[model samples]
Target: MIYRADPARYDAMQYRHSGKSGLKLPVISLGLWQNFGGTRDYPSAMEILGHAFDAGVTHFDLANNYGPPPGSAEELFGQVLARDFRPYRDELIVSTKAGYYMWPGPYGEFGSRKYLTASLDQSLKRMGLDYVDIFYSHRYDPNTPLEETMSALAQAVRSGKALYVGISSYPEQETREAHRILAEMGIGTTIHQPSYSILNRWIEDDKTIDACGELGIGVIAFSPLAQGVLSGKYNQGMAEGTRGADPRGSLRASHIEPRVLAAVDKLGAIARSRGQSMVQLALSWVLRRKEMTSALVGVRTLEQLKDNLGVLNNLELTADEIAAIDEASRDGLMELHPRPSGWLR
Candidate 1:
């Protein structure tokens, strides 16, 4: 059967302007970093993507090296687009990045124009896209000249391969420089994708969030649930299929120490008091910042995706609730958690 999107999709979700740009993003954007890869169950991915679009998620985030084998996520997403989303292409905001490791050789990765340009071409081909809505640098390549990276992003826009350019996980100072260089190139920085949640507040402490607010670069927080820690799944103990049990997963048992569990327990209590689940509270807390344009969530199942979308129904976080989360995260939460190593392919 041919898939037709709901006519009332726009009415299902609220949209926010990305930074100061005219483009707007659904408050709950979907990230294809995990289950959309080629190695994963294709039918499951199709279900989630279909439901997400039906529920009004317009933005779908991807990267060149997202899958376990790398690049497969784009390959899979391309298939989905051709099959079910071709008619809705104009309404969707599809983005991909290239700074991380892709191919083997030295020039295969990082911020070089050669790598970025070639990677985007490959991505466009894999995703069957004429041009991506946004292309990101993926990370700060300290080894490469900042000018070189920014110029490559400019080249992407100049070549009409990307409508906008952005940077991810860049420090405040570096973010300022990149934004300046992009403006000089006549292409304004669109948004920044960072790892932010109650457990990980480095963006706030490092002033990246503050800098983005001042510079007018929108922030879409990835890992807003802290890699499932804030989901309350491990409050009692790690389950068989949970991230804590998966050897290759980002979350480890050590990450859920007793102190963290206690914090989660307190948070769960607060969530119940508000008639919301732990995941909903975590997402609402992240979106509380006026500077936050959207929250990028990765869902493994259709139920999880729907739960994430339901957060938009009640985004209000009371002052006391916010303070409670702050107090709970204050102790032992200062440890630097591992962000996706942008260098790793």
Candidate 2:
């Protein structure tokens, strides 16, 4: 079935400028990290994406290794663009990353000029895009010199293959260095994708988000629902058919320890008191940060996507509610969770 977007969906969405850049992102964005893989059933992906655009999600996030087999997510997303959104291409903000394991050999991953350039080309081919709206270095590579990585991103923009470049899961110090080098090369660094949620706050503690405004980089917070740990669905008990059972889902049994469950219970009550579901409350908390430009979320179904978009209806997180969340997490509630690749320095 061909997909279509609902034009009247913007009545409830509020947009924010990405860092200091002129581009604006809706409060919620879609991440193709899970369900949009080529190995998965294509109909499900088209359903969620169609619902997303109809619900006012303009941005789509992708990475080189987002699927069971690497690069399939981009390939699947390309099919989605062709099947459903060809005419609306000018209004979409599609992004893909390339720093993780892609092709397997030495140059297949990391921050070398050869790896990045080849990765972008491969991503473009999979995405069926002449140039991506944004391209990202999926993670930092200490082994490769920073100059070589920055040059690769510069080359992407110079070659008109990527309109903007970004870094993901990088430390505050590395973020500053990359921003500086990209600026010197005259390549624009538009945004940084990082994991941030009520249960995860390392980016806030390290001040990487605050520094983005100073460095011309916007912030996209991924996993804002903390792998569903912050939602009412998990507040009762291990919900059947939840992400916990998914093979690629990152939530470990240790993450569902007694204390974390207790925390979710308390937080869930607070969300109920405000007449919103725990998922909505948790998502709103991430957007509570003025520095965060968008919340990039993953979903297995269209229902989850719509529930997440409902967060746009209430961006009003009161000061007292903020304090309540802090109080609930006071027992070092999931403090300083590492930024994917390794612990933050």
Candidate 3:
């Protein structure tokens, strides 16, 4: 059967400009970091991608090292793009990144011009795309000069391989430096992808969010649900099929600490009072920031996607609600995991 998208897909969704750029992304963007891998079911992944677009999620985020085996997510997304999203290609904002360890040897990873250029070519080939909407340096490479990294990103735009370029997991100072460097090259740093959640507020402490706002760079928060911890799924304990249970997953079992679960329960109560699910509340909180252009969500099922999208219904939070959340998130409760070294933070 042929797939037809809902004509009213733009009705309920909201869009915000990425930084000062003309590009506008859906407040809730779908991320192919986890579930859309080659190891997952093809039909289910395709269904989720279709439904997300049908509901006004115009942006799909990916990275070179997203899948378990690396590059598999792009391969899977390429298949979906060819089959179902071919007609709506112009309406989508497809972004991918490179910087992590993608393969063996020295040329496989980091911010060197060699690795970034080669990795992006591979990503475009895997996704069967002529040019990605936005390309990103997945992380900051201390060993590589910032000029070298930013130049590679600039070349991507000049060469027409990417419409825009961004950085992810960069610290506050580095975020500012990246923006300045890119500006010197006559390119704007359009967006910054950071790990932010009620349980993980390093962006707040380090002022990366502030830097993005000051630098006119949009922020798209990844892990707004703290690897499913903020979703209230682990309130009882770690379940067998949960992300934490998967050894290959980014969420480790130790991240679900007792204090973290306690904080989640408190936040869950706040969600109940507002007639929102845990997922909705978590997403709403992340979207509350004006600097937050979007919240990147990775879901396993259609139900979870719908629940996440429902955040748009009541995206605003009252002052009292903010206070309650702040109190609940006070102290070291947010420090569930150790801060990663260097730009990985």
Candidate 4:
């Protein structure tokens, strides 16, 4: 069977401008950071991709090292692209990143010209793409000169491997410098990807959002559900087959402290009061900032994707409602990272 996208797909989701750029990302973008790898069934991943597109998710975010065995996600996405998205390619905004430990040897990772350049080539090959809409450096590299990193990103565009360039998990100051460097090279930073959710407000606490807005760089939030803490699936406890059960997963069982669980329950009550599910409320809360271009979510099932898409219907957040949510989630907040750790690694 073939996948034909819904004709009315664009009518349901809200698309927002990516800062000063002409690009408009869906309010909620799908991320293939978890699952969708070689270990996961390809048919299920393809079905989720088709359902997401039908529901108006135009952006599919990926990275070079997003699999249990790194690089498998891109390979899986490539297969799906050839099968289902070949005809609708023009309507999608696909992105991939580099910067983490992708392969053996020093040249396999980070912001070095050798690594990023070679990485993008491999990524393009893996995704079967001539060019990714946006290619991100993935993280800041203190060891590599900012010039080298920014220039590699510039080369990606100049060489036509990536249309735009971005950085993820870069500190506010580093982001500002990267923006400056890229601007000097005649390629302004297109967007800044950060981890932001009700339970994880590092971007807010560190004023990264304010910094990006000031610099005219779009901000797309990842982990908006705080690694499933905001999904309400753990309100009762860590259900079997949850990310918490997977030791290799980003979400740890220890991350769900009693206080955080209490906050989650409170937030769930708030969601019910607003006539939405905890997932919808969590996503909508992240999009409350006008500066936020999109909220990136990882869904293992078609049902979760549909539930997240419901946030598009109600992006409104009253000041009082926001205040209430802030209070409810205050205790749920994770402390700021001393340095870019997990994802940045």
lDDT scores of the candidates, listed in order: 0.87, 0.82, 0.88, 0.88
Worst 10 residues of 2 by lDDT: 336-345
* Clash list (residue pairs), candidate 3: none
TM-score of each: 0.96, 0.94, 0.96, 0.97
lDDT of 1 at 334: 37
lDDT of 3: 0.88
By TM-score, highest first, what's the ranking? 4, 3, 1, 2
For candidate 2, lDDT tens digit of each residue in 40-93?
Answer: 777878888887888778899987787756788888888888888898899899
Model 1 C-alpha lDDT per residue in residues 100-187, reported as the tens digit of each score: 7788889888788899989999999999999999999998888889999999999999999999889988888889999999898889
lDDT-sorted candidate list, best first: 3, 4, 1, 2
Q: Give one clash count per candidate, in the order shown.
A: 0, 0, 0, 0
Clashes of 1: 0
Clashing pairs in 2: none
Question: Candidate 4 has which clashing residue pairs, if any?
Answer: none
For residues 295-319, write the lDDT of model 4, one tens digit per residue.
9999888888889988877889899
Which of candidates 1 and 3 reaches a greater TM-score? Answer: 3
lDDT of 1 at 108: 87
Q: Lowest summed-lDDT stretch of 10 residues in model 3?
A: 336-345
lDDT of 3 by residue, 1-345 (tens): 677889999999999998888999999999988777877877898788889999999999999988866899999999888888899999999999998888899999889999999999999999999999999998888889999999999999999999999998898988899999999999999999988887788898888899999999999998889888888888776688788777766775546777667778888899999999999998998999999999999998899999999998999999899999988766424553222233321
